[model samples]
Target: MSAGMAGREAPLSRWTLLAFAFPAAPISAMGLPLVVHLPPFYAGSLGLGLTVVGAIFMLARFWDVITDPVLGVVSDRFETRWGRRRHWIVLSVPIMMLSVYMIFMPQGPVTAGYLVFWLFVLYVGWTLLTISHISWGAELTPDYHDRSRVQGARELLLIIGMVCVLALPAVIELANPENLAAARVASMGWFVLILLPISVAVAVWKVPERKAPRPEHVPFGQAVKVLIENRPLRFVLLADLISGVSGGIVASLFLFLAEDVLRLGKFSSALLLCYFISGVMFIPLVLWISRRFGKHRTAAGSALFNAITVPLILLIPAGHPELALGAFLLFGVNMAAGPFLFRSIMADVADHDSVQTKQTRTGLFFAMLTSTNKVGAAVAIGLSYMMLDVVGFVPGGENSAAALDGLRAVYVWPATIISAAVALILWRFPLDEAQQKANREILDRRMLDAAAAAVETRTLHPGDAQSSGAPAD
Candidate 1:
């Protein structure tokens, strides 16, 4: 076995895991602004209109259909002395910083053209950073439960970053209520800008990238065929799509639901804060549950729980922010469950594919997962905003009973149904820990055989080995 692949069964130190997960804080910090804050900021505050904003966001994600996979392939096949995933992550930093500035801190009158242009640019950077980071994580270790720990640390930091960002808006709201939307959105932007570089620096500096076995060159057509044939990949993607759409619909509409429907107004940020903080508290519990019940079953349970409880949001009194907070608390219990478990599951799925094809396609697998997730988000944003417009719900304006009812229905029903579907898809996932461990054993044995063959060749050709930098003893 290659020295880099030698310790396939050992656990990573907690410090290393934290270093690896550090950048997730900033990346996830960026997510809240993009999903929850940006659409409304552009549409309502900057006068883009709901349909225009929705289309812009959707088209940007559609753009991901191209970038995600291409980058995935490039990162998987290409490498630098710095490492395969690290260089792309470093390159993504400046691109994201520039785009974040343009999108969040618009200098002039922003047009639909401006939004579309910068958004496309941002997703390129986002895809590069995200795909590289998660693919790197997948190759970090081969152990089943350890994978959960790695992703759990990431999800923990993700919620913490979200909580910190959301807290800013709430603080701003308390101190100054005028032009609150603009201030709060810009606050999120600055938070990401300042922290992204610092967090990424610590991660790349501290976390050693694992050297995956070099993939044999497969034709593009055959590669696509191999990916399409991956059944676990299919299950993870579909479940992720359903869950993404469910989560995206709620995230995109949360401000509307809180301010217009629930009359929480600026306190919406506090409610979001509560939601994410709840996620922070529960991630360890979720991880513990995953280890005991198995990752897929634990994920299924979380989805099922969400499905049962999401509709109960309707029971909260419209004017009571306290009731809304309590409901979000309930909903947030499972917030950290699906994302981490699914990514960990995808790591195992990538290993299964490697066993089949003798190629490490972690980046490509994660790229497809990311693409489905973004597509789901795109569909959710486009569909929800259109529904809102169709029902005559106006942002930052008083609404009739029918419009409010439309907003409420659009918010809860789709997510509830889709959550149930996610549960069903994951309930009987086939690739358990035992299967993954066996796949690893197969790959390891092949590596051992390959290593022995190389040694034999070198012993028979000492002159050739000497010329190629091997000592001829």
Candidate 2:
């Protein structure tokens, strides 16, 4: 055990957790803008070719996926006085800020090359900040319920950020759908710029990093072997992909669903706001449910709940705002559960791995999951759009009735099946509250043993006793 884990307690305070999670606000604010707002803004507003812009975004995502693991490996191995995770967070700030600025505030004529270069740079920065931030949070506590509390607060702040960005564009566009072209996207950019630094500053200044002993550097081949044997991680990553793809399908089809199926095209913003608000309001309830049922079981239960409710949108009669609103409200019940639970569960998985292998590879585990999540998102968006295009469903529903049905089919069925699979796949997930506690005990024992060995070694050779703290692996 490294000196950092000697006499360490695994519980955290509310203030500490809050400070630890605050950066998620700005980071979450960047998500909707990058995925939803930026593409249309560039193609439609700036007159860039739609095909070219789409290709550039795809290329950027590919680049982002590749970098996630590399950054994770780097964060886990790099040690410094400042900390492992926070230094990456600090380094990522300027790169992200510049990327955000370039994407949202383009000056001269934009080309495919320009979009490709800057978008790739931006996602690399996003991956670095996000993977490190999440890996840091996972290391903060070993208590099963404390993990939920920390992540629940992050989800809350994330919702606040999402609503802020989503509402601004909708509010501005609602008043006059044609007005404030750049300002809509620009507002989110400015929000990220202003919020990113302040949140990072607070998190760094207030939250203390837990410097666990670094594991002996494993070669890449050995790292792969270790990962292949991490059963809990594999199970959770499977759940993550299934649930993430389902949600992504919904997001990809949301605007089309509201416009053509529900006839709420004019009030899409209001509909989105209703969904987010409902999800945010219900998080406390989910937290309580998690405490009672435990993380994996609760996650599976929520997936089942979503499976039951999400597809009901297909049955609602067209041109009925009341029915659509009611369905969205119901669907919102499980919206926050997927993200909140997956994060908490992954933490447990990391703990399990550390206990079994004597290595804390939180960063690499998180990065691999992050990369797979992007794959799910990409598949959902691409497949849904391709399916729509195949069925002759135009963007504005300016098409035949058959085309609308095609859009509706693509929207509902994939999500229904995927959510169902999430429940089935995760039903037997290995790590639970009791199992995690046992794992923590093993880790503590190993830590104490290592520390004793170090002390004995120093006593035997007094000249070798370096009055210094070492990281615990």
Candidate 3:
């Protein structure tokens, strides 16, 4: 039977998947605040303006252009008794924890310099952990459909993390309602601090990284050539970039849209809770749809659904949190569809690359994928914030109607159009189950051949055959 068919015959147990996916919860908790809460907190509570915060975030992300691929290459080559990917995860925990503390709970007088320095450290750690973790997942199973289950489980935990973390700020918003920004950041810091180490330990200790073919060390130029020739990787990266941009813009502006434009400041966190809860609810359905159809088709349909429905956000009446919640719920139903599906597709691409090149470059491919996501996020946050600034849209302050209109425009149109483009780009993605299955079979044969050759060489030295007749002893 084919690799995918074999995988269907013996899928990973739920406990194994859970042990592997647990770390996603804490990582995503940190991420949710960075996109939804940190920008506003820094801009409004800490007295740094939007433009400065956006520029700093953008610059920090650009730093990843260097770190991500470099770490990817290094990790791919790295091996230890523990494993290639797990050590990096352990190494990242301290760096990430320290940076999280500094950024989320600054001691005194925060400045642009403080933000810049800590953000740089944070991204390095983030890239290390994220690329290693994902590369590990991609290497776990070669089966096309099983890859989706792995990624789906991770994304599910991610949304759950977002929901759980948002609950803290939501409750704080309701109870105290004073120094809310400070409280939000502080609570998030504590949540992440307590959870990140525990989650990392559990996953690294309980789950073992699967062994793969040791990759030949290709020169940089040839490696670049291989990456360029990868058509499926290109398509997945483009689709991911567009989706990331859409998500980044909406995430960066969600609180702003909730508080300033929709006049539901107190309900902002609650609305986010509703949105993420919707995603958590819908992930299983999306995964099932991908199983029924193809991953690419399901992802495209989801993107199209978002594109069609996002513009309706403009119609939400001012100060109507209930109406806004309904709109957010509508928009969020397909939110879980694109990310995990594209990641699973990329895993298949890595398999194809391995077959053609005879090199395991899963880490590098996932790094490129991660880099595009960061680039999209950087551009979205940088440009969107600058645009908001140009329109004189102030945060946590009264705004003119023109400013509100500008906010609404910036929030709605870019995401709507870009999400549509994602649909088009991924509609006919070249890689599919049959292709990946073929690649897997090829790899399996190659492995068997190599093993047989090794055994034959060990069993019969060059002199053995010649001496066989004479050395009858």
Candidate 4:
């Protein structure tokens, strides 16, 4: 019934989707491996205590929770020639590169003071870039399936990035121990130098920007009130947080299991590379299933699959490297499905919010999502560290039986948390196929009404109008 819905065309090309998706690959690839591997690296290599390492990780993530929302609000309010979201993407790439370089290649001694400061800066910069990039993707299309396609492309690219990061560290060490450290530095630098420019170019050249409507003099307090009052948004945020924490717990502990339990040694990097590559391999399969079954059902099935598969990872006894590799491969398959569906659901939630409020608040929606993910990351990293401390995890040492037992506990207990999260997702995620269709229709109507209003305003104020102008004006 709505004007915007009367006739809407699908996206013209895959390039349009790639424009939004490609940039995310480098960012996700960089962030996921760093979060998974860096804590252990700092604890063992830098000789920081578990609690101290945990504290630093948690502090930086908590800082992201606060700043993410601000960034989202700022992006939503932003109006620019390069376009609202693209400009942020351009600005964030170099900063992200510099921050990552700093974190991995610390200049001074590995003192607590130095570690904390660099970690804080790196985490904040990464969060800013990610929040902006994600928001930009959400705003690219209002169509449901198109949004999924966009996300799938982005996620696929992200997996490629992860594989690169995950594999390179070990490859460097194995090939030449004499220059292992130099190789590590060069690998990161090369990816940053090469991928950063490519990502920005794709985003600028390929993705079309939407002209977001300016808010009609609404107060900041009112915007907050609307965000808080929206039940669907609230549910989506809570579920994402719960799921994020569960995933984060697994990620934070994965390296420890490979190194300490499986005794994989330098091969740990290869195993991780395989895990990421396996996830990437499953993207097409997940996307296919999602198309057939719908996003929520597909996600629920993946969560259930993960609930069963991830716990089996605990069954791999010490001295069985092949079994561990098999487990990671299986885990990666299930993990791949969840993200594809999860990101699709997130875009749907964004559409629902736009319909309800008559505003394109992609940045705010993604900001909230990112904030919860940070909270989840905080809980996972903080608690894993605390648990390590409790279980007598000794960094950079031959594992005593007690330390090994602690490592096993970290591996096993998080299963319970993950199981509960899957349950919440199955029961509480209220946005289903029919609901999404209805919401899309509503959004189409709103966009039509807004467009009509602009036309009427142009007619009334003819002197101020230009026949062909950019969307932002």
Candidate 5:
């Protein structure tokens, strides 16, 4: 091992940290726009049928599911002069930039096939960039609080992106186009074209990677077995799935609840702004909680509190935006905690796994986290839509009293139950400060041993060494 590799890591400089976190803003900026804005842009602006648009989106997301793990595994095994993660990030940016332009700024005679093809292309780029970024962040720090800071900065940037994207439509309204969707989508295309490349380039240039030794070959079955056997990873992923599905259901039903239950349909924008603003405001508090109480307790406690508060929405009368915002303030606090710690916790799981197996699977661990999140969200949204239909809730027509009641039930119950389940399940999460430090200590020793062995083998058989400098698969 080089002296630098064996030496203790310097604390991450603020510029490097912010640059590391920079790309998240644009990437996360896409989230709100994709779900909230893009559908209307396609259906109303482009005159696509709703059924066709829905099918196209579903197909794109499912395709994303397949690509995520593949990309993760590919990234885990990849090596380059630019380093494992930054090279993948660089590769993904151009693909996504072009695809964004294609999807958002469609040319003449758009069809369902056009949407599906370009959207799938967009997801491919998204998977590559996101998985690489997450795993890279996990690799950046080993200290518990530092990991929290890294993910917190990343999550904070993501929310900033979401807030920024949410504000764009209002800006677009001032442009006053005959086709709002066209202008909005075009603006998003330009945003990605400009921001994605610059942020990614800055990170690639400025950040220093701790290049862990990559073994020449890890069998497919062995990778699966390690993943399955990592109890902490399994627990965290399960907690993520349950909470992710709950949150997805709430998001899917939020507009319906705003209209039919809370009667704040007109104030939906204000209400959403409140949720995000409160989230941004509460990040420091969540981080403080994580540092003081540990990530597991902070996340689980936040979810438990959130679970307690979600059902209280049922008690708020119709048309009370003030009360709704107040409720969401609590929601935002708890919401902030989950992502902050969940990602932090996953970093620990990655570290723990690397220690156990003597291999780095940071990318694959985060792949499980990101892919499960997408899948769970998809299932939740589909089931929520199905249940709403079964409960006789009409889209535009006057809904019955019973239908409104069902909407409230759908929004509140699934989330509450699942969040509580997440809290309960996290009670068994194994990593604590001592355990994590012990894992890192062992990993450091392993690095020293590998480095010494490499030197000895080179001296003994300089011409015959094989795995030394072998290309990452």
Candidate 6:
């Protein structure tokens, strides 16, 4: 076993980590398949207007953002024999499943108001559950490589889940010719009901939480202040926000490009399924490259590559649709490297916090990170919708060449935004492999010294110091 694995040999089993990762895949997969696609489905199939659909998505996302950090903070403070994080996982899975059911299973003649209410509840509950789960995984292992391994596994599972969700809607349609919408609704409902509980159970049962040292009774205000004062963490959060927005913009606009620019009809979802499948295949290759070049360099190179490719995708004429599809494959390659790198960086931030405060606040760190990501996602989706409206792009209608051109422009924008994110990573984000290793060594030494001091204090009483030290019973 390695030095980092010395004390962790017993608790950190492969099955334990796999259980933690299983739920992440399904939950993340739902983002593109449900959140992004469901809005357009509501507008086109259910006869709700685009304005109302957009409003519902925006409102629900806003609620999700607020709930993320609050739940993180609450989970951070929670103390239980079952562990700080597992109880949340156990309780939230059912609520999360119910929310999915409610969102997909609409009543007779769905109205804008009803959609908005259900979406808000569903999104808010999902955010709370997911943020807690992510934080738990972050706290699972303290070793640098171990952290990467854990997150890599989680991201890989997430990709698998995404591919499954993307392919399911199409697969269901093939089996049931009539009632396509009902098939979609039934498939999502079944996925949630069956997968959610099993994933949650695996994580809760297999992954044993390490005993966190009891935190000193600091006031809540002081804890918040300390978190704000942590300079490295603040920088990581900012960089992550910028990168997340760039990624979110690309995701939010994928459907519009497929339907309007590629002209793929209902097969648009299948094309997206292919794109995501490509990403899943490439994730391990990207992780290997990160091991050689370092996560920062790898992420920067991939982002720059994506930026250049996005504009090139726009240049592809309608004559050759294959060129555009090829660009999407490259886009997937770029995306595969990012989440693994970003989540690993977050683990580093958590390590730095634990060293400084002597308090394990992984839940708070992840919660804040999730909150920022939600903000980025909201901004990206809102901006894309506004841009579409400005370009006079009509939903579910034949478009002019200019409208197709506008859709191409939307595809190009995310590449430019991601390129800027690359620049930010190059400048900020200071810690390298050597720096982290040194930091960990120093922390270990400090902990040992503190333990020795406590022993000395216990040995020496107030009055009989030197004499008692000779033979203390």
Best by TM-score: 1
Give me the candidate number with maximum lDDT: 1
Which portions of model 1 miss their true places by more than 4 Å? 1-8, 174-178
lDDT of 2 at 442: 78
lDDT of 1 by residue, 1-473 (tens): 35335536679998999899998988988888899989999999999999999999989988998999899989988888988898889999999999998888887889999999999999999999999999988888877888888888888888888888888876777778678788888888898899999988998999888756677776878777877888888889999987879989999999899988899866787898989988888898998899898999999999999999999878877889888988999888988999999999999999898887778788888999999999999999999999999999999798999999999999999999999998999997889988888887887777777778888988899999999998864
TM-score to native of every candidate shown: 0.96, 0.92, 0.94, 0.91, 0.89, 0.88
Error of model 1, residue 390, in angstroms? 0.7
Best-to-worst lDDT order: 1, 3, 2, 5, 4, 6
Per-residue C-alpha lDDT of model 5 across residues 3-120, encoded as one tens digit per residue: 3233356767777778899999889776666665565467556777444565566566677678988899899887888778989999998898888888778877988888888888
RMSDs, each prediction?
Answer: 1.9, 3.2, 3.7, 2.9, 3.8, 4.6
Instruction: Give the Å shift of residue 176 in candidate 6.
Output: 4.4
> What's the C-alpha lDDT at position 248 in model 2?
66
| Tens-digit lDDT track of model 2 for 225-318 | 8779888888888888766577767885676688766788667767777888888999999999989988888889998898788768778888
Candidate 4, residue 82: the lDDT equals: 70
Write the number of the candidate with greater lDDT, choosing between 2 and 6: 2
Which 10-residue window in model 3 sums to the lowest lDDT? 1-10
Cα lDDT tens digits, model 4, 2-95, are 4545325566377677666777667766677567766776776667877998888888889888888888888778878877777777777677
Query: Candidate 5 at residue 407, lDDT?
Result: 87
**lDDT digits (tens) for residues 273-294 of candidate 6:** 7777788788778778777877
- Once superposed on the true structure, which residue ranges of model 3 sit more than 4 Å away at CA? 1-9, 174-178, 217-219, 461-473
Pairs in clash, predicted candidate 4: none
lDDT of 3 by residue, 270-336 (tens): 8889988999898889989999998999999999998899999889989898899899898789888
Question: Which segments of candidate 6 are over 4 A away from where they belong?
Answer: 1-14, 219-222, 319-321, 442-473
- lDDT values for all models: 0.88, 0.80, 0.86, 0.73, 0.79, 0.71
Ranking by TM-score: 1, 3, 2, 4, 5, 6
Worst 10 residues of 2 by lDDT: 464-473
Give each model's clash number.
0, 5, 0, 0, 1, 1
Selected candidate, larger lDDT, 1 vs 6: 1
